[model samples]
Target: MRLVVFDVDGTLVDSQHHIIRAMTAGFAAAGLEPPPRAEILGIVGLSLPVAVAQLLPMADLATQARVVEAYRVSYMQARGERAAPLYPGALDCLDRLSARDDLLLAVATGKSRRGLDAVIAAHGLQGRFVSLQTADGHPSKPHPSMLWQALADAGCEARAALMVGDTSFDIQMARAAGMPGYGVTWGYHPAEALDAAGAALIAEDFHHLTRAIEDWAS
Candidate 1:
């Protein structure tokens, strides 16, 4: 079966606002200034600790760890106050893709297993994926470990799998894993960055994303 692996944040769900807010609170709790929204968006596909390190390159490891914990607490609190909704057409695309018997679906995300589980349950997406690889057990995005584990779990070859996401990290990871990557414009990173990162094609919307995948599959 052909495998389709997807990213979570900035890919399926639009959690930018909540992410920015929580990150701001996190930095505040850590007694540091928050980075710009654009800067934060650029790091969406990375694991929390790695992302925090990038955001606070000048800070020591202890400081970064504190920021990570603060961010997690802040994010958990924010989740109670607001839900991060899937972008329009995201569910439809997933539904259509899942209906194809020749295809297998999976998730390769930088989110922790608990976070991924929460999103799946919150969106009622349980059982839709055949494999779920998360930061809890694997290295962060752009490392290719998540994709490698996902492909192994699905028993699929690299060439038979595609990574779908919105960031350069995803595209680079797919490349490193010897697979094609498809970028969706409605997500985090800019289209130009996606293209530069070796995306085979960039889809402007879910309809285009579906068509692009089908075209590749055919």
Candidate 2:
């Protein structure tokens, strides 16, 4: 059977507002300044610590860690206020993919296990994925560990797996894991960035993405 691995934020859902707001709180808690919106969004697919470090390169490790914790708290609070919504057609695409008997769906994301769980619970996506790899147990994206573990969990070979996401880190991670990566345009990064990161195809929307995945599988 083939495996289709997905990214969470900026892929299936739009968490930019919550992310930016939490990041602002994180910086506030740390008595620092948050980066610009574009700069912050640029690191959407990375683990908390890694993303924090990128945003605060000059800060000490302790401060970065503090910001990470604060971000987590703020995110959880914001999440309760408003759950991030899935992009239009995401459910339909997932439904279509799930209907296929020859494939298994999985998630490989930078979100912590708690955060991923929250999203899944909020969206009633329990049992939607055969494997769920998160930052809690794996390195951030652009590292192949999550995808490697996902392959093992899904009993899929790298050649038989497809990675679908919106960021360069996702494409790079898929490349490092020896899998073909498909990019979605409606997410965080631009199409050029994804193409530069070695995406096999850049889909315009979920409908196009589902078709692309099916075409690739065939």
Candidate 3:
């Protein structure tokens, strides 16, 4: 079987608005100024804890914890009203991949279980994925645990798997796990960064993404 692992936030869905809004609220709760919009966007694919730490390196542990909690609550509230929607063409791409018996879809995201579940249910994507590796169960991105788990869960070897994501972390993880990395242009990271991070292929658009995966499967 061929394994295709996807990243959650920017790769599948456009959640930057919710991410920034919640992070801004997190800073507010901690009595600190919100990070610049550019900085916040730059760290899109990172796990919450790592993102928080990188954004607020000077913050004490207590303050960081509060920020995390505040962001979680804010995200939950915002998500309840209207969640960050999947990108245009995402459903079609997923559908095409899902219909292929040779391909086994899986999710390797930095989102915690609660957050991942919310997005999955909201998008009616629960049945689309065969496995999900959440932040709670493994080390965050740039680590191979999630990808390794995905391979194990899908009962596929690393050489038969492909990692699709929007950031360097995803590319690095794929490299560490001996799998090919496919980068998406619509996601957070720039094409240059993905190339530098050792991405084997970069999809210029959704159609290209689908085509690339199909070609790989064949």
**Top-scoring candidate (lDDT):** 2
Cα deviation at 35, candidate 1, in Å, is: 0.9
Instruction: Write out the backbone clash pairs for model 2.
Output: none
By lDDT, the candidates rank as 2, 3, 1
Clashing pairs in 1: none
Off by over 4 Å in 3: none
TM-scores, all models, native as reference? 0.98, 0.98, 0.98
Q: List the RMSD of every prediction in angstroms.
A: 0.8, 0.7, 0.9
Query: In lDDT terms, how accurate is model 3?
Result: 0.91
What is the overall TM-score of model 2 with all chains considered together? Answer: 0.98
1-218 per-residue lDDT for model 2 (tens digits): 99999999999999999999999999999898788999999999999999999989989999998899999999999999999999999999898898899989999999989899999999989887999999998888899999999999998999999899999999999999999999999889999999999999999999899998888777
lDDT of 3 by residue, 95-166 (tens): 999999899999999899898999999999979888999889888788999999989889999999999999
Worst 10 residues of 1 by lDDT: 74-83
> Which window of ten consecutive residues has the lowest lDDT sum in model 3?
38-47
